[model samples]
Target: MATLIVTLSRLNARRHATAPVAQGSQCRTETIPMPASGDLVANGEEIVELLADADCWVAIGADPDSSLATDGTGTARKLKADVPYTFGIQDGEKVAVEAA
Candidate 1:
């Protein structure tokens, strides 16, 4: 199976925070196996870091559907093996991934 290491870092503090925190003050990480489809929802202003173990396809903010092929077609982006990619995303966005 293909694998993706996803790290999410908050760009700001929670709205109910009693104290101020710097941007990127909080974070979380997860390792996801692909060929299965699912959604990763962000809860706050955040950025995502994706590191793949094998070449794969990722669809952010959209359903993967019948896509996710090795040829790198039909997905929002293609992830190369052993490489790290990062990007900013709005709160409540969903990201999806699968084997390419």
Candidate 2:
């Protein structure tokens, strides 16, 4: 069986706040900087590394403070904000957003 490392960042329910990732006996927390991407910014390269060995699930809650750009226009300024976005990753599957 593979291991899954879940890290919490500003993208979680609490803006700029993070939670601990506790699994079995391992306990560690790190403050991740929001990314240049959209709302769920922290779900970046590091998260991908964690799920590399297993089918993974990212359980992010909604974030109201997100300054997401309007639609595909990308008109809104890329505000320095954080939001929550969750996704599941299966090994060998293309890692990207899926249609709702």
Q: Which candidate has the top score in TM-score? A: 1
In candidate 2, where is summed lDDT lowest over 10 consecutive residues? Answer: 91-100
What TM-score number comes out for model 1?
0.68
Candidate 2 C-alpha lDDT tens digits along 1-100? 3223333222123344464222233222332223212132333222222222323222222221223334653222221113333233232222211111
Q: What is the lDDT of residue 52 in candidate 2?
A: 21
The sequence of per-residue lDDT tens digits that candidate 1 reaches over residues 3-86 is: 888777775546668753435547776787885544566677467888889887776554444354567565468788999998
Q: What overall lDDT, based on C-alpha atoms, would model 1 receive against the true structure?
A: 0.68
Q: What would the C-alpha RMSD of candidate 2 be, to one decimal place? A: 14.1
TM-score of each: 0.68, 0.19
Clashing pairs in 2: none
Quote the lDDT for 65 in model 2: 24
